[model samples]
Target: MTDYDVIIVGAGGAGLAAASAASENGASVLIVEAAARAGGSTALSGGVFYAAGTSLQREAGIEGDAPDAVFQYYMTLNQYKLEASLVRKLCDDSPAAFEWLRSIGVEFRAEDLYMSGVDKVRRGHRAAGGGAAIAEALEGSFAGRSVDVALETRVETLLIEEGRICGVIVDGQPVRSSATIITTGGFGANPAMLAQLYPDAAIHGDQHWYIGAPTCRGDGILMAQAAGGQISAANRGLLLLTPGFAKELESYVPGWLMMVNREGRRFVDESIEYSVMAAVLGEQEDRIAFGIFDEASRMASKTTSYRPAPNWTADRLDEFVAAGTLEKADSIAGLAERIGISPDVLHTTVNRYNDHVSDKADGGFFKPASFLRPITSPPFYAARICAAIICWTGTGLRIDTRAQVLDAADRPIPGLYAAGETTGGMFGECYASGGASIGNAIIFGLTAGREAAALARLHAPLAATS
Candidate 1:
């Protein structure tokens, strides 16, 4: 006889979500997490939930946002390289997923709804207390549910019989079950996976680093691959730009800081979302850009909230310059020469930027007036920036709209399901939105749980398996 009806590998947002849905569907659940903690990368995230038609949107007076609109925007932004049916399922179930997380004690404030991507829609719902709160809520759910959590216990392998998954090999022992859901997170921490899956970010060597949980070692993806599941295309995760001024996570560059490409020309609005900024920067020469700002801007900068500008504060700037991390010069031309750009083009770019400073309008990029600042003060500074920060790897096992793991032939592997970062094909080229990953985790985790539960109900619990 089987020990449980459904076995969930990893205890991240997706795994916990799967267990939640499976238990509600009358399946006995077992959650195995490799780390001492339960949340995985979800707990370390910003806790934003990217969703449309959410109750928070209406409460915040944001209208004209629906699942279909979200679907179109996502498909358009990614250039339609994603799996349409799966994307549709994610879009349609996002609102319900939002409500479900709320029902489980996670908080999403209406006022916290903000624009999190290239789209103007305010669909990013920032949960109170960030990802830690959402992770806590999901883990706390174990108190009332029929879930057995095995911490610091990694799944050795997916146990298969008759070409179907039956359970798992945990700690060299067999744990029999009717169905298994793989929710293990990404592989940003693994150097082999980084070089193999994400070459762009891997080129930076030691300069590159991951922002997710250290336990995100791609355990679930590897197991699925060994079980004959397919791996999606590589280089698909969100990569953030950084100046290498210490590994401190800097998501947004200060609006006051101007960026110039190799030709010493401005390319982006400088204040756009990180995903868009990274994508745009990736197209730049050598996928590199430089942040230009004056001494005054750095001195006047404060630690910002809506967008973090901690690295630009006067003290931090001075520290960086002293450490040779930031190049300093008494004039703009001198700064351009140091950064290896044409001084003439840099002069023209600065002249036009200064001309509009009084009007508080960026006529070229149309940057918001509130963030505009003239780089007129003496002693200009520049820092090298590249989109090298690996947020969460996008290469993983392939799954369908129903969260069922698919083999090389795109056929579903019975009793095998996957969700969250463990499953690939959710993201296309760029990360669609801020909360897209978390939303994917919760929505597909819920789906995988229910699907595995149904599959388990039909089976006699892996009866008499050799």
Candidate 2:
């Protein structure tokens, strides 16, 4: 009755990689995806792969970059809030996983390598054609293989025989399999799941938006949970800071703009990384902050630079003011009154920052003198910024390093495995890096496929007898 040795739900980067890997190991594999095409949210991404101790690093003239370094940095970044065992395994096997992708025709250029997340060492490997290219490469990897893809098909139910997951129910029919892997992507497109799990983004209301594909309905998590899988209990995900003035993403606040908390006090350097910056904003009053800048700074922001603000242009500022999204006043106290803050505190904060500008230094947060500019001109403006852009959700089914979906009691759900965004335990309070999502998908997808294949091999005799 077993139709395939392994059945993978969702054909994103993880599902495709899993199908190819399982097929390569002499296991019959079938990839079922709901989308018209195979690529999932990963195809809509920038296509960066985060790894350590790879030939790409060596070819780029960087040496001594290893998994040990990644572990140290990741642990410190998340304060060890994540499962240490899983992170350690991910770091250890990252290089091998990356090489496997390359062998499958995914092109990564040494020149495109750059520093991402909080890593002092460079680990972001940019694909030649961005995320679409990586998706194409992963899809192309199916060549000359026994991997079958069922596109535009949603997995209606996870069919469990007895206490073990055996296969799935699609279109009212039971498709038996030795093992099932969930890689159906995240719940970003699911508003109900967003409000329940990611309250931080939910608070943004209309400002919030997810960059992933709309097909990410979180069906995998729900289906797995129905099969006794434990869902992750946390409100964690990657969010980008934005003016909420427009839908376009604004990752970094220009250093020239001064940021103030609810009490009109400066808290952090404006030029910090988005993941780190968003975390700091959550600590502020009401999880809100304001970007304070003048006409000069707003006008100068239009000049092409590494951190260009397409939403912060002079015209946009005027539009925001005209639309009342941005508050403006000739005096600092007046601006404070409009924004509902103490006039005296606003006045003092501005004066202190102006003093630092005059001294050509950032005595408060040391935000680099080059980016420090005094905002003394009339008609000062302040725009509300929030961590609204939902890049990836962190809440999903919990899994071990072996990619087995665990139950509420921390026991593995037999015949079930998961990888990619559908599974949690990879991310913590902070998103590890730019390429962590894709890297996680391909890496653990590779693991899940092999593990499921090994399981199928073990179950062959029992299936035949039954």
Candidate 3:
């Protein structure tokens, strides 16, 4: 007899969502998580989700917001490098995903926030208490339902028979099932895996760190690869770069500060999206840069732009300086010396930037007038910044729109489904700023759960062999 109708590996947001959906659809489901807890990186997240054509937006009185508009915006960010079919599926099913989250008891605030690079109306919904709240809601729902959750059970291998995935081997015991879904998160915490995929981290060597879950070791990717799944976009992933000593992900550099390369030269509009800023930093020499600002700019950061949690207050800045994470000086030349850059070049760069600020225009990079601030007031401050990978691993097992793991020939691996960060091709060359990550997890995870359950009910259990 089949152990369960659907066996979901990894009890993160995706796995829990899948288990709930599958069990609600009249299929037996089991969730196996490597960690003792259910929430993975999802719990640590800000609990934002992006979906277009949602009732939430309608209730918030946001008008003229259409799915097509959302689709175009996502495509534009990645320059259409993402598979159109997959993007189309996500756009078409986004509204339902929003409804699904609410059905699972995840509460979203009525207010919406504008995520950077989203050109249209506000579609980003924040969960009532961030990702932990969302995770707890889902976990509670799954627990109350008929599904079974097994914590601290690591799937060492995918058990395949007759060229079909049957179930998984946990604790050296084969647990057979009709279908299996891999919801394991990305490999950001695994430095060896990251260095192999990310070029900057590879070439520079030891200059990068990650802020994702300690349990995210790319388990699902490796398992699926061994099961004949194709991994794609290994070099592409999300990066969050900032000047700080904390290994955690929070980075709060004010936009008004001028970002300079190692030669003490300005590059890129400082007001650009943080993800793009991280990518630009990767392109610089040694994958390093610095954020330069004066006393006034430093003080201004405490009130404006630097927001929410982990804020950059004056005290925070002082703490960073005291901790040696931020370099400070009373003059621009002295600041350059402290940060180990040429004082003359730093002076020239700041003077030109000051002229641009006076004109309220950045002629070099076209930074917005609102972000232009003169670096006239001293003591000056500089922070040595480096690029670090956040949650997105970029590399994952390829899957079709139905969330079925695909082979190198683009054929579906029957009885095998995948979702969330474990599955690939949802994102492309660039990542959308808002809740795309968690949004994709909910959308595809639910879809995979539904599909796996249906497939399981369609087939009889394999005859027992001893």
Candidate 4:
């Protein structure tokens, strides 16, 4: 058995952050990852960290914001589904988190425009090249450190003794440690698990594309549950929309297109924020939605303001059309007929939209004119887009503010610590603005590591005194 001060399962953002913090505090740390890589979902993310009143904003000559204002924006948008305490913590600690990242050589640049359709004050921050940049910076900080990163190693279960977590079992062997941090992400990639957690969402085939790594199989959650930790709000997960056909690769390809539902009607103003779009996408049956566009829409995408996915391009769109993966028609009616929808319904939908544009009224749909580009152009295009569930489910082992996994009775499971998605329901019912996941993971991981290290230190002294 290999002994260490701390053992962290899952080498994603949270685990890596925990390892760094523990090592910095003079504690030996081991990070065991199932995949060969360390980045995990953070590498696959958009790398935007939303923080109001950040030091970066102040340095850039932008006016600082109040925490109350930040809290108000999130609460208003999320409709108070989120826990007040956790939301308040996020707003309060985000600035410090941003400063911490910068201290570790991570740099961020402000976005030129707010993400269309989400209501918020300007506070979007992105690392260069998105997530990879942040991951690289984190990797740099661990060079030649006492932190041990073991890749391609799967943690089978938690090793508990006398009601306290002693370590973990990995690959049929026991790795002993004084403390363990479970950062293994959500169960979005596991079809069986998704079916169990959300039966109604599984009906539509290929509705969600697992944008995160396939290794996020909920190992930590399973282990923690077996050890008497409680899980809360297992049904809440973030829903995202990707371009049609990209589901085959299980990747997101965002572009300038209009989204519609089964009734051939637009449900949201595409120009609005992404969270609003995500919420709208979640409401549809099987979380499946469609993207309708035309040749003009494709052309306009050349300079489209928001491009979240790299794989989305005009060439790819043309290829999808040629391969019969995407449908194209000379008219909206023809396009609707090909996609197995009512032509009259689509036609009337388009006419009403056009009338809205002419009359300067929202026409009951409340779609913003910015996204209301008439779908009347020639060579109409349509693709079946659905909610691409990036497997960061919000359910996991319940933990307190200190990131200690608690039992069903709300008592801390001794020596058992959890961070990231494994410490579920940290964000409560609503996922706040960007970087909330990564932020929580890092902050809680640090807390767990330091707290565990202190406990381990106390054990030897107590034994000596005895």
Model 1, span 352-455: residue lDDT tens: 98877888888999988887888899899898998888898888888988899999999999889999998888787778989999999999999999999898
Error of 4 at 325 (Å): 2.7
- The number of the candidate with the highest lDDT is 1
Q: How close is candidate 2 to the true structure, as a TM-score?
A: 0.95
Number of clashes in model 3?
Answer: 0
**If candidate 1 were superposed on the true structure by all CA atoms, what would the RMSD be?**
1.5
For each candidate, the alpha-carbon lDDT, in order, equals 0.89, 0.87, 0.80, 0.71
| Count of steric clashes across candidates, in order | 0, 0, 0, 7
Candidate 4, backbone clash total: 7
For model 4, how does the per-residue alpha-carbon lDDT over 288-339 read when each residue is reduced to its tens digit?
Answer: 5667877876666543335445445678778888887788899888888888
Compose the digit string of candidate 3's lDDT tens values, residues 169-244: 9889999888999999888777778777656545545656666577889988889999999887767777766565
Q: Top model by TM-score, which number?
A: 1
Candidate 1: Cα lDDT at 205:
86
**CA shift at 72, candidate 2, in angstroms?**
1.7
lDDT of 2 at 242: 80
lDDT winner between candidates 2 and 3: 2
In lDDT terms, how accurate is model 2?
0.87
